[model samples]
Target: MASALRRARAGEGPVLAWPLACGSTVAERTRAVDFAQGVLRVEVPDVGWRKELQSFAPQYLAVINRYVGESVKRIEFILAGQQLADRADKNGRSTRV
Candidate 1:
């Protein structure tokens, strides 16, 4: 059961990371970001990082809009969850990942 759940989460992982792909340097450190039902949700690695990102929300949104080629009106940031945080740490320096 645990393994199955892990697999499911692993599959959904990429979907969550998609929006952070072209974001700012702060966004580059992001663990996950998802656009669902008109809301953009982001997960950063830590509180300090989250605060740093909040200061630059507008810039991050602009980058997201450019990468996605659409207007993203809102963004919410949080402390990264387990699976997502691990992925971020692994791929934090790779733009092509």
Candidate 2:
């Protein structure tokens, strides 16, 4: 299901690409944005990144609005499980048991 969604999104230009290009360090540090949902969901790897994003929310929203054509009213910062698992793999830890 997720793969299909990703494939479909890949066809759309700028919706997802813009965020990757212009997102702040905080945005990049977090997981990818879901443009379909209109939510910039960031994984708070640590409190520092969380704080940084919170501080820059307004500016970030402005950038998002410009590309998406609607003001992204909310930015969701959470610890996403997939991002954690990917990090574990990068660190040489197997996610599979």
Question: Model 1, 1-97: lDDT tens per residue?
Answer: 2233234342343334344543456546775555554446777788897787778777766555544433457667777674455466688653334
Pull out the clashing pairs in model 2. Answer: none
TM-score of each: 0.51, 0.51
Report lDDT (Cα) of residue 36, candidate 2.
37
Task: Please give the range of 10 consecutive residues that has the lowest summed lDDT in model 2.
Answer: 2-11
Task: Give me the candidate number with maximum lDDT.
Answer: 1
Cα error of candidate 2 at position 76, Å: 1.0
